[model samples]
Target: MTQTTQTDRTTTGAIPVPARTGVHELDPAEAQSAREVALRLVATAGAVVDDEKWISAAAAAWQELPLSLRHAVRAFRRHSGSRGTLLLRGLPVAVDELPATPGHGSSVQRRATVPAALIMAVASGLGDPIAFAPEKSGAMVQDVVPVAGREEFQGNAGSVRLSYHNENAFHPHRPDYVLLICLRPDHDRIAGTSTACVREVLPLLSPAGREALHAAEFTTAAPPSFGAGGERAGAHAVLTGPASDPDLRVDLAATRPLTARAERALSELADVFETVGRTEVLTTGDLVIVDNRVAVHGRSRFTPRYDGSDRWLQRTFVAADLRRSRSHRADDGHVLI
Candidate 1:
């Protein structure tokens, strides 16, 4: 897909905000095959989503997927392009039998469903699923829906324009990939999930702006959902690792520049994101995988009725290697303590 960027710094942001209109969809046969595997795993797991054997079985099934599909998933896992996002449409999500969108969060029953199993199957292709103990009862898959009282809040439950952010940016064990599966879309179909890749925005940065972002002059506060309250993380660079294609870790809603120069640099970066970020309106059976290290994601504002038919999405955090967080987990489990 082609999109133009608005470069007028006075009127437009540094990056031109555009919507992603293209998708990488699976063929009908592939979708059916994936559904069969997912349903089999769901039946085997029964009502237990946290069982190690069940998860392992799901992973093993993922390995048996068609080589072509596996290769595509692996390529994205290794390196996403300037968009830093992969949209897979027509994955088998058993929506007809799905219960009403959970207004609160994921439950064991929901986790054992076919859609959840499909998510786990896809995640196995990328990495190990992980969750934080303080969030959503440490369930590996979290239900994203607009909560009744959190409409204006900048969080998963809010219907407002959520600021772009790396998943769990303040945590040392933050996820490497954020997998979101759409079970139900917003009524108006206008609620788009936005993503901005540092790869795309880096070219727009001035040398001074790039230098400032590479320095350790920014601090990010832990979102309230993490239960850290007002806790802030140590000083760190907004961009780090290799200079050619650095990693990104900034939460527009929670990050703060620690100096005057850093503040100006951050403002410039924000403009770049606004000018280039792309939004995608997810549909049922669509899974959007994001490289959390190379890009940030947020959601656009949309009205939610709070009725049973509101938008619904399931999210999971994944790491390329789970062993890195061994010390932060119990029995070296998926849940990060």
Candidate 2:
């Protein structure tokens, strides 16, 4: 673990850089316990992860995971510390046993694989897992692999430097937690998943910048992953809730400032994010959970060989309060329309 912090710009006054957190590494025994739990889930869930019965089974299996793992996740759900990110290393992912990374767009794991079971079980512990109808066919577990022709795109299929964004920022019922489990690293191991929390960034912003961000002067359009006819958020504040510890809601790629002051504020916010953000190069069996309400996440640029073994990470979204989006979900299911 390295300690890296950026100095605040002289023009913007002094910005305090928070201490970096260490990865929570599971011992061999704990890892094995998790593996058994996930394997049992695979047996019970059968071959369909999207089935409501599978989700119910996963929720039951969540209690069977290692007590340490469950405790960590429960504490994070209560308060996500200064970084608003939790990285757990040494889960139960069998890298060598996995099939070739999918190269197609909108890839999702509908089958009840080991990795899929592990993520879904954890998702149930944190909250109910949810997905957008327009994104990745509304599957709970989605593949975060690079697609052949979408190298320059901003979404999951791209290998470029993805700008920081709150996942599904334009949606009224956006996810509260975003979980990514790394099954394979890039060939060069340079693709870093970075996160910046508003807690760490608020001090770096100017008074005027903070005020402008709090005002309803921004609109966010749905990302390319949503395709055509996706809904957009209108006239929303980039920062909401208590000014002391406000929630962040801005997508660097999709949010647009409405006024001149708002534009300058957005730029300032971006600068602060770059200054205080932390990047982690994930390895196999590593899981990173970002508090979507407090932090925005993105990825660093990495070259994809397009071979069978490119970077492969599976993702799932969790909504802390599933009832809030009941109307958007059909038949009270998880997928939000």
Candidate 3:
């Protein structure tokens, strides 16, 4: 299909993606095997490698999978999301062994070892090829981190924080999709993944609340993960209504309202999250995809063991095709925009 730029894309039903085939869940056995290999690689390394290195390794590992199973996953990737969301039953997450995050002295790109190729495949399989562009000098997750956040956070095997949020509300162009590959979960931790669809909650808003959200500006900042020095972040309208494809921008941690009307909209938005979002506890070897355009995602608060195998999930982002925002992408084929 020719690239869709500035086109009307909203419908009454869950905003659908013609490219999205259908939801396909992974098999437990397949997920476990990937976890096993990842754990061993991490155990050998002793520290987290960089995202690029791990991505390269994962692509290789996935390419090496048995033909039948490999073919199945390749098929699954195509039909996963509606322009955005796709869920993989497993993605090799384990609590016993995981790569360590490289400290300041070393390159994180070398430490981010991944066990399964599903993540690489999913991003590439669904929207576009995975962009290993490090957001910061040496960042981990990809998609240019088009948006950044600065919340002090950690996820235990079980304990985790899944606060509902849009990945990069501060940016001018947000991603069409958000992909997560699970490597481990705190067995004793109960942190859950939280997600909310704007479509699901739009009906609950009062007319005035809706209008306030449609206004053109509100403050938003990077999540603590990228350490956006609170001030470096900027503001954006919480929502901009269009006849089709209404643009929604939000971040629980950084978004600030300028007027009481905006505040009311924010409150209504919060209520929608509480009353209309989806919550699922991500387990070891699972992969979760979010429609960055249709839904916001976060983790429920949980404690981390800080042990070698605390709940660790490898994250990556994908923009539909970099064609629309070529100017901002890193030369390395990754979207820095």
Which residues of candidate 2, in runs, are more than 4 Å off? 1-22
lDDT score for residue 240 of model 2? 98
Shift of residue 135 alpha carbon in model 3, Å: 3.9
Q: Show where candidate 3 strays beyond 4 Å.
A: 1-23, 28-84, 92-116, 129-162, 228-235, 241-245, 335-337
Q: Which candidate wins on lDDT? A: 2
- Candidates sorted on lDDT, descending: 2, 1, 3
Off by over 4 Å in 1: 1-23, 105-110, 228-230
Each candidate structure's TM-score, on Cα atoms with residue i matched to residue i, is: 0.90, 0.93, 0.68
The digit string of per-residue lDDT tens for model 2 on 1-337 reads 1222233345355533422453577899999999998888888835589999999999999999887777788878888988999998999898779999989887899989989998999999999999998899999999999999889999999999999999999999999999999999999999999999999999999999999999999999999999976678989999999999999999999999999999999999999999999999999999999999999999999999998899999999999999999999999999999
10 residues in a row with least lDDT, candidate 3: 142-151
Backbone collisions counted per model: 5, 0, 45
User: Across residues 244-315, which tens digit of lDDT does each residue of candidate 1 receive?
Assistant: 999999999899999999999999999999999999999999999999999999999999997888999988
lDDT of each: 0.84, 0.92, 0.55
Estimate the TM-score for candidate 3: 0.68
Give the better candidate number (1 or 2) by lDDT. Answer: 2
Top candidate by TM-score: 2
Worst 10 residues of 2 by lDDT: 1-10
